[model samples]
Target: MAADLERQVAHWLAAARTFRDAEEFASLEAWRAVERDVGAPLRRQLNTVVEELIALGDATAKLIATARYDAAALSQAAAAVQRFRRRYFQVDVTLDFIGDAVNTRTSPVLRAALTTLDRLAVASMVSVLQKANKPVPRVLVYQDKGTGASILRAGVRLWAPGAVMPCAAIKIVRHNLYRPTSLFHETGHQVAHLTGWNPSVGAALAQALGHDEELRAMWTPWASEIAADVYAFLHSGYASVAALYDVVGDAETILHWPIGDPHPIGWLRTALGCAFARRCFSEEGPWVALQRSMETRFPISAADTTLQPLLVRSMAAMPRIAEACLSAGVPALNGRPMTDVLEPARVSPAALSELERTVGAALWTSPHWRETEGIRIVALAGLREAEHPETASVWINRARAWLTSEARAA
Candidate 1:
């Protein structure tokens, strides 16, 4: 039994070493490139975890050679190696995601935008976590199918506060330029995963309800969604609101009718989004205009009476909830609103009116457009100028180049 166990240990060590040396899984050149683009601070997190795996293998090998060679000792050593092998697989999975992320890119303009977003988001994660004296939360963004965006966490649970449990994968749509606003919403999820903000926010919402069990019951389901919505607004302003409309503005009443779903009803989601916008910006902005339009389309009478009051109350509390969440001083990370980090150009009324006039004439020429708007605004501008698909695509491509150059300069 001892001999057999020793043989197994040899095999396990060999396997671990093989994995450690493998090139196809995570190439050295690839990681170096990522390190350059993402910076060493974030890259170091992955490298440290990887070194741990290699050290585990070394320890396993040392145990078999130096420790007692009795049946019990061998058996214990073998089991330890096997356990690490399983854990190593988790690390392997994350590396594959990162390796792919390093190599992925689309068009020049869009790729620039995506890369900028990744830098800003990861930098924000590092800054905020450091301020709170917490572990660094490592996040990477990648492209995938579908219209919206989503996040994949590394471990079963995010055990450390502000640590992405090992890493977090942000999957963004490939070509849905108009709805990239969803990226802000997706960033909110990454924020929650890193900070475990949802549970904290949920508790706050429950406490704010003040023993109103019924409202509390309704509020808990939508806490995370609302938090994401509010965060998106802070990050992208009216553009985020516009993106929300593009994605779920036409959602059925049935989708929101189920109190069990994590999201509030479609119209209610718009109302909450608009409400958050109101708190952040003036009363006469694009968000307020969108709120009125949505409310007109889907009034409280459209929803069941039981939900109407709850939805209304939820809207009323949006401002306070948003302020409280931000006051936690972690949402934007680095204590700066996303607007500051993003440095989006605000389109003046004159510029917008001029854009409208140009679009009407089907001459989507890039004017000496001085607005340093974010990618979302540029995308929305392209959509609004849509006289045809080809024209929209051309305009968006130009807009993307402009935004990307501005981001690089910043």
Candidate 2:
């Protein structure tokens, strides 16, 4: 029995030692210093993870030191150490995923554009949810080096003291500012996950779907994706829709999918976004054209026949689903919908048009034409200049400068 106890204590010590080494490697002192400045919330959370590992190690060491070691006690200590090690490893993986949060490979214009987008996306949510005493979630954008479609990831499962540390990973097609609008869509994912909107939306959607179990099951998987789409629509309007088309517009890829896929068929998703725009803005020209463009571009025949009925059912329920989601969502204004919060008076068409005319006439104008303009409006202005790359670049540059300047001036 005594020999067995010794063996168990050695096992516990080994596990604890492994955790301590991984903890040190994961949160190196020098790297933590730089990350501390990048994100205090994440830094604090990382520190806590490290401390937990240390405490577990110390406790196990003391257990091994005592001349008396019971089998049950040793077993419990070993189990505790293994459990904490698994959690510590998860935190470590997240830290590695986030890395240094700096990229020198991107150009000034593209880097600035990314930084501007990140701020705007965060501010959009903060403007709404902060009033309800929710901390503004922090998102970090990284230029992805891997192949395949651009991806957005978040550590929604990361354990932390208060609220799972909301960290977003947005991998962009590096140096491609034209597609920056996707950032809003990706950031929307973070918002949906952190705000607990998916389950709320699922319950509300289930209620909306009524006795249709098939459609409900189909739509539940898509709750978060739809929430993100609606969020993008409320924030950037046409820019996001246009960006969506650019990314998944191909017929073959956009057409259909298995039930496990998180996003609905691309055509359906695009139509839903257009429907949201029409309902909210009531604008006739580009918004109407966008819906027509998506439908004409990706015909319904491209959608998988097996999933078509479910997709149709989901599309039918989307308007009310969107309305319900927004109604019960974090009110960014005086209980007004997030659309109102994102597209207020300052970013009204008249404001954007007025700024465009003035800024267009003189390229070197004060550049603060729409100092109070929301990032969405500025992004729209940038989109409007798409015909002229130089002008578009100027708008992007001004947007970066404008956004950063305001952030500092605040």
Candidate 3:
């Protein structure tokens, strides 16, 4: 059965590639070459398949837009798709199959919900930054984990391995093959990255604002992860909470680290996702309901306690960062704002204290926290402390001294 599935998938991929090549008309000569190479019958068949795939994608979008909240249906569909993709594709064809599924699924309610959430999130971000009319053109929806690793690998191989760059296209890795909400979460990252909306501030916060060790550890890539989470939270609105938890839950079950993958663990990633979701949706209505869902589903822990103060500090500093961007006269892309969208829920001192206690407790015993969330907690704490001038100066001095001492010892 597996062998047969693999053969079918290979044939489909080959046909798809041939169709894609023939369709990409570069010049008159290139067009002629494609025509000569593809022949008439194959070209016709390919075109038909391409059209069918496109129509399928449109139909799927509509289905998601209209479907009622049927968890059982969603779960079943997701599982079925996963089984199909796993059985059919060799070398982890999970992403391509899932992407195709999302593109082809037909749920109008889901589509409508996604559209509404996308608009509100984008509007809020733009409004807060005072760039009210920017045109954020596209949001790619991807399924998480299987696809995420592929994306990370592909990005590294094609662009720069171990380096971050502005991706040309927006792609979403869906949380589940069937449940496509993570599409919105990834869309948030795509929009923010493409627009130059929040990348600089996020980088600066990770670098200049973090503690010495934290800065050293996280300065390279953590900013992108955190920024993506923040954007996902703001743009996803209330629906984002469930989508995020689903992704995290799926990741916890599926993703594994053999040695050197840079991404944090599934649990920590989910915790961060939940924290950001709470910040965005803690207010009222659907957003509030989403927050409650996260609490009930994921359950915050002691490690999360450390995140409280960091979240507060970061949230407080956003306005100032926006002011700095405005002062710098950085041009907005398509009239979008230059500011970080502030979530309405303010971080309380009590919350921060509780978070710290929770993190400390979790760190002491739980392998999950110690191996994963603990690092993030420390990194976040350092980042928070680095934002204050006094603390930053102290940290900088200590870092310089440490570097000098290491050099001498060497």
Report the Cα lDDT for candidate 1.
0.56
Q: What C-alpha lDDT do the candidate models reach, one value each?
A: 0.56, 0.56, 0.37
Q: Write the per-residue lDDT of candidate 3 for residues 1-410, one digit (tens) a residue.
A: 33333344344445434434433322233222222212243234334545544343343333333333444354443443344333323212322332332342134333332332223233333433344344433222222335441222112122111122112122334333323334434544544554564556455544444444433343234444545555444433333434454455552432232234445444444444444433433323333444355445544342246544443343344333323322221135343333233332222223334555766645434545533332233222332332343675554443233212322333
Runs in model 2 with CA error above 4 Å?
Answer: 1-38, 66-88, 100-114, 130-133, 145-163, 166-178, 186-221, 281-284, 287-290, 309-336, 344-351, 359-371, 385-410
RMSD of each: 6.8, 6.1, 22.7
The Cα error of candidate 3 at residue 176, in Å, is 5.4
Residue 66 lDDT, candidate 3, scale 0-100: 34
Report the C-alpha displacement of residue 184, candidate 2, in angstroms. 3.0
Where's the lowest-lDDT run of ten residues in candidate 3? 153-162
* Candidate 3, residue 321: lDDT: 30
Summarize candidate 2's per-residue lDDT along 1-410 as a digit string, tens digits: 34444465456445544533423443453333223324566556656665666566566556544534455565565565566556555655655555534342144444444565555556666765665455665555555543222334445555422225445546655433434656666666766665666676667667777778987776667777777777766666566665676666775677767558888767767776666656665556465776676777776655768776776677777677656655544432334445555553333344556656755644323434432344545456544644245676676665455544533444
lDDT of 2 at 195: 60
Against the true structure, candidate 1 reaches a TM-score of 0.64
